[model samples]
Target: MGAVRVVLVGGHESADGADLAPVVQQLPEAAVSTPGRSLLSQVRAALAGSDAPVVVLPMTWGRDPVMIAETARTLRWVAGGDAHGRVALSEPFGTTDHLIALLRTAATRTATRWPGSGLVVSAPRASPFDDAELHRVAHLVRVHGAGLEIGVACVGEPADLTLAVDRVRALRPGHVAVVPAGFATACPEADALADVDFVGPLMTTSAVLRVVRERTAGALHDLGHGHDGIAAGLDADHGHGYAHSHGPDGDHTHTHGDHAHAHAPHAPHPDPHATSHASALG
Candidate 1:
C-alpha cells in the first residue's frame, strides 16, 4: 500500500512550519500548509497523479470556517470536482471541549499556587461561533472545575485590555490569574494590566502534538474503511466558487460568486466531535 500523505493546515497567521517541525518529522509523509495560495499549491502537489490516501488535519482549537472552507475548495479545484474517496479532512486538532479541559487543568494549578487569585481566560477574537464556543468553554470551566472566580475576555472584543482587567478585578480575588485559550501567548498588553498573573498558552506541550496524532490516526482509519470524511462535506458545503483575501491581522473576507449550493458551513453532519466519519458525507 502507498503511504498516506498528511497535510497539517493552520490559520493564516499561525506559526510557520518551524513550529510544526516536530509533527512533520514524526509523520513519515507530512507537510504543513496555511490557507489561500499556500494551501492551494500544497493540495495540488499532494494530489498530483496519485490515488494514494491523504489526510488533512486542521491545526486549530475550535471551529475555523475560513481554513475549513478553503481546504474544501482547494481539494475540489485539484480534483476537478469533489475530492475522491481516498482523501480525508479530519476534525480540527482540538475543540472547545479541549480548551475547557486545558483551562480546567490550568485553573487547578493556578488555584494551588496563587490560592486566592481569580482566573481570567483570554482568547483571540475569532468568528461568532468560535467566540461563542470560547464563552461556553469558560462557563463550563467556571461552573464545574474552577474553585477561583473565573472570567473570560477576548483580545480584540468590544472591550479593551484595561476594561477587561477591570472586569476581572471586580471579582475581587487576591490577584488576577490570566490564562490564554486557543493560542499560545497572552496579548502583548497583558503585562500592562495591574496585578495580573499570566498562566499559559499550552501550544508547545506534548498534549497538543498528541491531539494532532490522534486526529490524523482517526482520519487514516476512516480512509482505510472507505469513508471520505469531512472533505466531502466541505466540498458539498462550498459548491459555489469563492475567493478569499486575508487581512494583516489574519482576518479573512470571502468573495463568493455564482452560488449553486446552500451556504452551510456548519451544516456538515457527523462533525469532528462525532465518533464516526462514515455518515458525514451523506
Candidate 2:
C-alpha cells in the first residue's frame, strides 16, 4: 500500500491556508501551495517523483472562480485532458462539516466563561460578497451556545468589529469571542480580533486543521474516500439560507459636520489590464 499524496492549494499569503496547515500535515503524505499559472507544472513534477495517489485540496475562503479554474486546469493536465481517475480535487475547506465543527468548538471555547450568555463574532475578509461560512459560524454558535448571541461581521463594512463591540456592550455579556473567519492572520479582519476578549484559542489554521483531519479520517472510512463525501455532506447539511444587506447606493447621502458627501459617478476604464484582472476572479 502506497501513501496518498495530497496537495493543499490556496492563496499562500491569505490566512485560510495557514489555518489549514495542521490538517494537511496530518495526512500520510501531503504537499500544499498557492495556485498559480505554473502550479500545474509544479504538481506534475512533484507527482512524477512520487508513486502515491494525488489528492488536491483547495483551502479557499469561499468558492472562488479563478482558483476553481486553476484546479480544473491542473486536473486536466494530470489526467492528460481527461480527469477520470488520475487525480481528485477535494472540495474547498470552508464548506466542510469539519469547518462547522471547528466553528462550534471555537464558540464553545470562547463562551465557556459565560456559560449562558456570550457573543460570538465572526469577522470575515473584506469583500462585498457575503461568505456562507460566516453564517455557518453564527449557526454553529447558536447551536453550541443556546442562549448566546451570535453576530456576523465583515471588515471595512457597517457590520464590522465596531458594530460587534456595540452589540456586546449593549447586551453586557460576560465575555466576547471574535473568531476570524478567514484563512490567514495577515488580513485586517483577522487582526481586528486582537483587542477582543476571547475565552479560548482564536480560530486559526491550527485549530481548523485538527477538525479537518478528524472529519477526513471519518469520511475516508465510511465512504471509501475522504475527499468526495465530506464536501457533499457539508453542502447538504448547510443550505444557503443566510441573507446579507448591500450598502447604500450612489444616491444615498452622508452628512459630516457642515458638509454633505455624495458618491462619485462611475468612471470609464482606460486599461485592459485593469479590466482583465477584475474579471479574472469571476
Candidate 3:
C-alpha cells in the first residue's frame, strides 16, 4: 500500500520553533495543521492528489477539548462538510492516561535527583476537568512514592505556578522541581521562582515520537483495509460533558449525550501561497 500522508494538528504554540519542530523532522511525510491558521488549506492540499488517507494526530495531552473539537470541525470542513472519510483524526498524541504515566516517571527522576524535594506538575489552564486531572495525577504520583509530596498548578488559573509552589513549599521539602505537562516548553514563569528546578517539556521526548509514529501507522493500515480507524470512534464519542469558564462571560456547560453548541466563526482560508506560510499551524 502507498504511504498515507500524516498531518499533525498541534496546539496554538505548536508552530513555535522549540515545540513541534524536532518531532516533525523525525517523522516522514508528516505536516502540521493548527486551528485558525491554514488547517483547512493544508489538509485540503494533503488530500488533493493522494488517494491514500491523511491521518491527523492531535498534539494534545487530552486536557484541551476545545482543540480537539476545533480540529474535528476543520477536518469535516476539509472533507467538504461531510464526515472525514478521506481525512481522518487519529488518537491524540498523548492522552490523560499517557500524561499520568509520563509524569510518574518524571516525578521519580525528580525525587531521585533531589531527595525529599516536593514535586509540582503544571500545565496551561484548560478546564475544571483538566485541573482535577492534574490533581489526580499528583495524587497518584505521591501514592506511588514517586516523590516526597506533589502539588498541582495551572499556568493561567487561580492555582498559578507561584501559588502551587507555595503550596508545595508549605511542606518544607529539601528543594522543589516544577515539571511541566501538556507541551514541549517549560512554563515561561518558572524562572521567576527562586531555587526551584524546572523540567523540560515531554513533547520533545522519544516516547512522544514513538506514539506519533504508532498512531500514524495504525491509521494508515486502517485506511488501506477500508476501516476508518480512530476517527470512526471519535465521531461516535465526540460528545464531551464539561464546563469551561469564559472570562467574564461566566461558565458555559455541556452535558453528555447528544449536545449542540456553536463555535466562533473562523475566517475563510486564504490563497495558496499565504496558506503555505501561515504560522499558527499548517
- Give the number of the best model, judged by TM-score: 3
For model 2, the stretches where C-alpha displacement exceeds 4 angstroms are 11-16, 21-28, 36-38, 60-70, 81-84, 91-101, 115-117, 126-129, 136-140, 156-159, 182-195, 199-282
Which pairs, if any, clash in model 1?
none
Q: Write the per-residue lDDT of candidate 1 for residues 1-282, one digit (tens) a residue.
A: 136677888762244333566657666577888866786677667777466667777776554555676776665555435456767788667655666667888899998988878887876566665566567778889887758788877666435555666776777645887887754554556666667777876555455556766777788887678775554536422322233333344443333432333324433323433322231111
How far residue 15's Cα lies from its native spot in candidate 3, in Å, is 8.6
Model 2, 1-282: lDDT tens digits are 135556667652134355455555565466666665455765676568765455665665352434544565545546444323445555454443434455566666655755645564554443333354456546655775546667765555634766776676567644455655545333343345444554323354455555445433443444344233322322221212332222444244434323454545442223211211121111
Off by over 4 Å in 1: 12-29, 48-52, 80-86, 157-159, 185-187, 192-194, 235-282
Which stretch of 10 consecutive residues in model 2 shows the poorest summed lDDT? 273-282
- Steric clash count of candidate 2: 5
Better of 2 and 3 by TM-score: 3
State the displacement of the C-alpha of residue 79, model 1, in Å, after optimal TM-score superposition.
4.0
Can you give the lDDT of residue 24 in candidate 2?
58
Q: Which candidate is the best by lDDT?
A: 3
lDDT of 3 by residue, 96-138 (tens): 5566667777888887788788888876665665566667667
Off by over 4 Å in 3: 12-18, 49-52, 80-85, 157-159, 229-239, 242-282
39, model 1: CA deviation in Å?
1.5
Ranking by lDDT: 3, 1, 2
